[model samples]
Target chain A: MSDLNNGRYGIHGGQYVPETLMNEIHHLEECYEFYKNDKEFNDELESLLKEYAGRPSLLYYAEKMTKDLGGAKIYIKREDLNHTGSHKINNVLGQVLMAKKMGKTRVIAETGAGQHGVATATAAALLGLECEIFMGREDTERQKLNVYRMELLGAKVHAVTSGTQTLKDAVNETMREWVSRVHDTHYVLGSVMGPHPFPMIVRDFQSVISKEAREQILEKEGRLPLAVVACVGGGSNAMGMFYNFINDKEVKLIGCEAGGKGVDTFETAATMATGKLGIFHGMKSYFCQDDDGQIAPVYSISAGLDYPGVGPEHAYLRDSGRAEYVPITDDEAVEAFEYIAKTEGIICAIESAHAVAHVMKTAKNYSKDDIIIICLSGRGDKDVSAIAKYRGVDINE
Target chain B: MSRIKNAFENKKAFIGFLTAGDPSIEKTEEFIYKLIEGGADLIEIGIPFSDPIAEGPVIQSANIRSLSGGTRISHLFELVENVRKNTEIPLVFLTYINTVFKYGTEEFFKKCNESGIDGIIIPDLPFEEKAEIKESAEKYDVDIISLIAPTSEDRIKLIAKESQGFVYVVSSMGVTGMRSEIKTDLESIVESVRKYTDNPIAIGFGINSPEQAEKYSKLADGVIVGSAIVKIIEEHKEDSGKYLKEYAEKMKSAMKN
Candidate 1:
C-alpha cells in the first residue's frame, strides 16, 4: 500500500475520498497521465484554445495606474478577455474536451461567482455534451446574470442550499452528484483544489496564463517582471500566474486571499491568514475550521474568493517561503475595483480586484524601474450589481 | 477475541448505525439501547462531521442536527463509555478521517480503547492511505474496518485479505440512502472477497426494508441499515426509540437463518 504521502505536495494533497469514488479517481489519473503527453490531444486542445476560444490574450500596460501609483510599471494579463469572460475558460475547455474524448456524455461542475459555470456551460455546448452546474444559492442570487447566461448556454443549474449556501456547499453537492454518475459524467472541478490529479490537472491547464505572460513580458520589456500577482480562492488563477515564474527566484509570486470584513473576525475567508492544517474537501491543506474540526462558513464580498481553504500547492508555497500570500479585505478590493475602473477605464472582476488591491498598496514601495504583472482573471460585468449593493446603492436586476 | 469478530459467531449478524447526539445525546443513548433490545448484534455510532461528502441527505441532515446540538468527540467517547456500562455488544465508530486526524490520530485511538470502541470505519481512508492511522489503531487494538464499494473491483481481494473485523460491502454506487432495489452484482464481489479472507461480510447502504434486509443477508453474512433508521428518527425525533426497536426486530428476524 502507498503511504499518505502519495500524490502530495509537502503533506498537503492526497486521495481523501470515499471508497466508491476511488476507482473512478484512479481511472481519471490514468487517463490524464496518458492524455497530458499525447500529441494528438495537445494539438486538438491547442486549436480549440487558439481558434475557438481566442487565445494569446493581451498583456496591456496600465500606464495611468503606473503613473498614479508613482512606482513600478504595471501590466494586466487579460485573461478576462477569454470567451467566457474569465480565466475559468482555460481549464473548462481542457477538461470538457478530455471528457468528450473519454466517451463521457455529460459534464458537471461547481461554481462560486458563476464564471466557472458559464465557462463549463460554454465548453459543453461547443463539444456537444450535456452540462450541469452546481452553484451555492447565495451565489446564484448574487450572480443572477451569470446564472441566466449558463441557462442560455443550455446547462442545468442547481442552487445548492446546503450548509452556508455558498461555494463550499456547491462543491459538496457536485461531489455527491459525481459519485452517483461517475461512469457517464465528469466533474470539471473549477479550481486547483480537491484531490491529487485535480489540483495537478487544473493547474497544468491554467498554467497557460504564466506561459503566455512570461513570453509576452519578456518580449515587451526584455526581462521578467519584478512580481506576478493573482487572486487565490482555491488558488487556480494564482497557481496559473505563479507556476512558470516559480523557477525565477528573483520574481516575487504573490497571492491575494479574500479577507472579507477582516481577518481577526470570524467573518473572513483568508485561509493563509486564519486557516490551520486539516483535511477537508478531499485535500489536506489550510482550512478555516472551528475547534471541533468542522469546516467554517467563510464569507467574502467577492463570491469567487469565498472558499474556506486554499489549494494544497499554495499551502506548500507558503511553508517553503517560495511564495507569499496576503489577505485583501472587501473595503480595499472595492476601492481597487473602482480605482482601476476610473483610472484605466477597465472594470475587472471583484476576484481580480483582490490582486489589484494588493498591487495598489505595495506598488508605491517598488522602484520606478520595477515591472509587475497582475492577472485580470475575469471581467467585472458579473460583479457590478453585487459591488453596487455593497456600496449601499441598489440596482434591481 | 475482538468484540467485532465475536459478533458473528454462528448466526448472521444484524448491524445498526446512528449518528450520536442526533436530536440529543441522551436520545441517541436511548436509541442504541432500543437497538440492542431489538437484537442488534453490533452497532455503529457516527461522529457527526461538518462536511460528510460520502453521505446522502438523510445522514447528512443527522450530522448537521448532531453538530448543532453541540455534540463533540469528547461527548461521543463519554457516550461510548455509558453504552459499555450497560451492554457488552460490539460497538464501532463510523466517521470521516478528518475528525480523527483533527483530534490527533494516536490520541483519538487511545480514547477509542479507553471508551471500549471495537472498530472504526473512515469512508475517506481507502486501502492505499491506511498506513497513516493503521499503526495507531493497532497500538490501541481498535480494528480499522475496511469498506468495499461496487467499484472496488480488483481491490476487493487486496483489502479483504488485510481486513480485521467484518468487511462493509456498500450495496450501491452512490452515497447512503434507502433504495427500492439494489442492482449491483454483489454476489461476485462477495465470492472474490471470500477467496481471500474468512472475515464476516456485512452489506450496507440502502438496505432499509425487512424484505431488502433478508434479501441482502442471503448473499452476505449480515445486512446493515442506516438512512432508513435515521429517517425514523427524523420523523419521530426523541420519541423514535420504540419505533427503532420495533423496526430493528423486524429487520433482524428477517435476516436470521
Candidate 2:
C-alpha cells in the first residue's frame, strides 16, 4: 500500500534496468503487487512458514550472556534455529512461493556463503520447483558442503568464473540467466538489494523477525528494548530486524559491518561508515571504491560479508541518521567468536560475530538495566573451520 | 527562438556525445569547446556507471578511461559548472539510474538546475517509475528526455507524451556504438515516432559515416554520431580537441545534406 512514487521513508525501490530485462522486471513488479495483497497469497505464505519453515522463532532471554556482559541485559532472537539454519529461509520461502504463484516452474539464485542457495534449494525441493544455483568457483571450493547440499536437494550448481569469481560474479551470471529465461524462471534474490520491489518485498518477508520480536519482548519485558543490533552482509538480517523498529523513536538500530583489518585499511566492506556513493550489481548504494572509482576488493573472514557494497536501503538509513553504523575488526570479531563459544556455548557465524563484537564494545556504555537484543543471525557451524584455522588449530583433528 | 530551439528548427543541431572525463578533466573541457565551435547544438555528457549494461565497447572504454581519469559525480558537477561559464549550449546528462539514486533524486535535480543543466536522459529509467523525478525535474525547468527504440511504437507515444525534450530514437537494437550502414527499418521507426509528438526527433547509435548521417538526417530531424566522434578523439588522445573539431565538422557537413 506504500506509494513507491513518493519514495517515502527512503524506500524508493524500483526496477531500473536495461531494456533487455524491463518486461521481466515489470512483470515481477506486477506479480509482487498482486500477490502482496491477495488473501490466497497471504494464506499460502503463512501456511509455508508455519508448516515448513517453523515460523515464529523464539526471542530467548540470554540470562548468562546478560550477566556476563555486566552492562546491558542481552536477549537473542533465535533465527539460527529456523529451517536452513538462518533467517535466510524466511525470504527464500516467500520468494519461492511467489515464483510458484506466478506459475514459474524453475528457480535460480546466486550465493556467496551458500546459505541463500541452500535455503532456496530447500524451498524448491519442498515446492517441487526445478532449482539451479550459481555460486562463485572460489566459494564452491570453500563451501563445498553447501554445494553438495544443493546438489542433494536436486538443484544443479554452476561455478561462476567471471570477474572476481565471487558473489558479485555469481550475481552477474544469475542475471544473465534470468534475462534469457525470464518466461519460466524466477531469480530468487538473496538479500534486500537488486532493483525495486525486491528490497521492499524481501524486507517485508524477513521483517517477521522484528514484528515477532517486538510482541514477544513486550510480553516478557513489558517494554521495548533500547537498542537492536545485527551484522550486515547484503543487510538482509539487519533489515529484517530493523524494519519493525524503524518507526519507533525509542529504539536505536545498530548495524555492524565487516572491518577486515581496520576501518582505515582498503580491505573492508564497511560501506555505511566508509564507502562513497556508487552503483554496484543493479542498484545504487554505498560502495568501496579506489581513487579512480573502480570497485575495490573487500575482505572478511566470512565469505558472505566479503562484498564491495551494502544494500541501498542501508545507505538511505545511514544518510537519514535513523540508524548508527559501526565496524567490527577481524581480530575483534574473532575474539567475540571465541568469547561467545566459550561463554554461551553457541558458536556463531563469523559474520554474526561481527555483531556480537559490536555489542560487546557498545554494551560497556550502557547500564545493566538497558535491554539489548542482538540478532543471532546464524549459527557458527559453517565458520568453525575458518575460526579454527585462524587460531592455528586443526579442524581436521 | 532560443539558440537550442533555433538549432532544431533550422535543422543545424549539432549533437555531441562524450564520456564526461575522457583521458582527464582538462581534455574533456577542451573537447566540449571544440564540439561547440564545430556547431554542436546540444551536448550529451555521459556520467559513467561501473556496470554499463547497455553500452558497447566504445562507450564502455570511454567510461573506463574517464573513471581512470578520476571522474566522479562531484567532478561531473564541476564539469557542468565550468561549462556553464563558457557556453549556453543546452547540456543533457546521459547516465544510469543508479547515479541519480546515489546522488539523491531531489538533490540531483537541484544540483543540475543550479549547474545550468538543461536536460537529463537516464536510458535505464523507464517511464513507469519516473513520476517523482518528472515532477521534481519540471519544477526546476529541467527537461527529462526519453528514448524511443526501433521496436517501440505504442511505447514511443507513451514516452513522447511523458517527455519534455526531443525524443532520442535509437537507430539500432544494441548499445551505443558506430556501424557502417544504417538499419533498414530506421525510416519506419522515425516515421512512427513523428506520429506521437510534434517535438523534433534525433536518431542515435550506429550513425557513424557521413553517408549514414546523411541518410539518417533525411528521416529524423537530426542525427547523433557518438562512437565515431569518440573514436576520432581517442585516436588523437594527446590532442583530442583538434581531432574532435575536425570529425564534428565532417559529421555536421554530412548531416547538412
Cα lDDT tens digits, model 1, A197-271, are 899999999999999999999999999999999999999999999999988999999999999999999989999
Q: Clash totals for all models, in order?
A: 0, 2
Best by DockQ: 1
B1-257, model 2: which lDDT tens digit per residue?
43345558767566888888788777788899999888777888888766555666687678777776768788888999999999888888988776776667788889999998888888767676576377778887788888776545557667776666788887766567877765548777777777777878888887777787777777777877788777876788858787788777887888787
Q: TM-score of the candidate numbered 2?
A: 0.74
Instruction: Kindly report which residue stretches of model 1 are placed more than 4 angstroms away from their true locations once superposed.
Output: A1-5
Assess the local accuracy of residue A362 in candidate 1 as a C-alpha lDDT between 0 and 100: 96
Number of residue pairs clashing in candidate 1, backbone atoms closer than 3 angstroms, sequence gap of 3 or more or interchain: 0
Q: Could you give the interface RMSD of candidate 2 in angstroms?
A: 4.3
Grade the docking of candidate 2.
Answer: incorrect
